[model samples]
Target: MKKLDLTKQEKEIVEHALDHWQASNLLDVDKVEELKQSIEEKGFEWKTLARYAFWVALVSLIFSVLSLFADDAMVRFVEKFYETPNIVFCLFFAGVAVGFYVLGFRNKEKYPEKTFSNETLMLAGSFATAACIGFLGQVLDRTTSHYTLLFLLSIAIYAVLSVKLHSKLIWVFTLVALGIWFATETAYHSNWGFKFWGMNYPLRFTLFGILLTTFAVWGQKRIHVLQPFQSTSYVVGLLYTMIALWCLSIFGNYSSFDAWTQVRQYHILYWGILAIALSLGLALYGMRTKDNVSRDIGFVFFILNLYTRFVEYLWDNINRTIFFLLLAVSFWFVGRWAEKVWSKGQSSER
Candidate 1:
């Protein structure tokens, strides 16, 4: 038997087969075809793809500018006739979506790499630009329909990009949109105190559950990407704790503390002092014993204390810039403590 070398395409196919084998042991005939298609699509030059992206962006800009100035007389007239501009707007979106998908299939051969196509580029730009425009529109006028349209477009675009590019970023964005939607919907129907903090709390808890689940999934993905989950876990866990504490503070009455507040806000100062001392003590013990978990726990408690001041604004409804000054002083103390402990530990080790 004679040894033979394979051609370039054959080598590529063999390499792909090995990669796919690692991905899955169960081989289907369709898998080979899918792999071939994926390789052929992804082989296009990034520069060429970027050029297509540029053109798509230009087109989107032109459409947006035209929409801005074009005698919205037609839109206005339709609005009067239908009496449902939002429904019309949503329907327009549906039509555009269907048209885009149809165009995608019709031109599949031209853009072998679906991700690098002009259509995909335009879709991505539209989503990104719309989100910004929508947010700006909301800032300018709270009642503007554009903001809702922007959220709708953003959610749709993220869903499409997640599937098309198989990118985790798009998936994360989609998850974020869902979280926002869930929270808004929950707040709409729930009672203020319970939703804010009491016993009959179904909707608010549901919203919180969704947010927690999203964070858990995001954290798991981050752990894989980061090689160490420690930093992310510390930060996210602290944020969750801070949020929970804020919710509790919102519902909690300050009558007991109010008794002390009569003496020039002395009660808050007392609580603040206790919180600072406790965080400092924990941090010191953590550093002395080389306990990373305890150090993180200290950070969490310290953040809650710091954040409590902000939450107090909602409770007592104070608008004092003095609070910012207090925050600055507190952070300075935390920094000084960290620096001292870190330097002392390094000196001892040396």
Candidate 2:
């Protein structure tokens, strides 16, 4: 029989199962060794190190690029281009972005394994496209906060490009642009007020997140074209919801910090209750649907919400040492429980 391809963790689980089988006399020692030899274990540690190194290198590259802006000659050289029409720069960058996108696409097709390199080029193209759109927006209107319209335009462009190129990276940009547009639009409508429709920004975003998550779920079921976006949309939605809940937990519906400061934490019990209820509800739904991501998100945020409440309500009243000790104990129990659950899962899989 052909051996199944497995990750390092899976290989470890299999080896443990093999040892159990061997002890039970289900397989001979030689056969166990043969099975072990058949399994290929990739160096997970090396992969992890390489991933971190790539991020560090990318950060360094960004700083290096930024450093060029610090040079007087380079700054002046860029300023000299101010005399040129913004539309000219927009058109030029738009063409360059298109060229880069084409190259990245071709590279992705030819060398699928070189994901980092292809993605780097594609990322540059995305940034260039943003610059193009930004300059175009400025050319059309040099004054006022109408840049929100340009953000909407960018979202549209990115949505189209993501579909055409089958690029999740571009889709991520689309989501980001959409978020910016929402914020800008809300700000424009609210005139930078602390409350809109009796809710603060975080509370409002919580509603937006819930709506987006609902739409994503519905779209996944009804729209074939949206299937590829399901995971990304779900993640983004959860992030928005969790972050907004966290903020709401801290600040409630107050628009200003001064108002929040005057109000006691207990006064915000309703917000906390709502947040907890929603998180737990999502977790319950995830468990029923067998959706691990949703379940994990829900559980993690549930714990976070509880911890946040503890800090808010107990930090001042509790003894410092005893409080920390209790926290330590709580985490220890959580760790033990998680280990037990993980072990059971591994055994069941075996």
Worst 10 residues of 2 by lDDT: 42-51
In terms of lDDT, model 1 sits at: 0.52
* Candidate 2: pairs in clash: none
Tens digit per residue, CA lDDT, model 1, 1-350: 33334555665756666556655766665775565444333343566668677677768877976785576876676457565544445555555655655555456546656544545644543444344534444445565332344455566866675456444434555555644554444444442223434322332443454355456546556644332333333345444433444443333324233433455333335545555565656566766787786576766676776566555553355545765676778779878977997798657543
Q: How do the predictions measure up, each by TM-score?
A: 0.37, 0.85
Model 2 agreement with the true structure over 183-224: per-residue lDDT tens digits: 778877787777877878898888888888887877665877
Against the unseen true structure, what C-alpha lDDT does each candidate score?
A: 0.52, 0.84
Instruction: Name the TM-score of candidate 2.
Output: 0.85
Q: Which portions of model 2 miss their true places by more than 4 Å?
A: 1-6, 13-38, 43-54, 82-84, 347-350
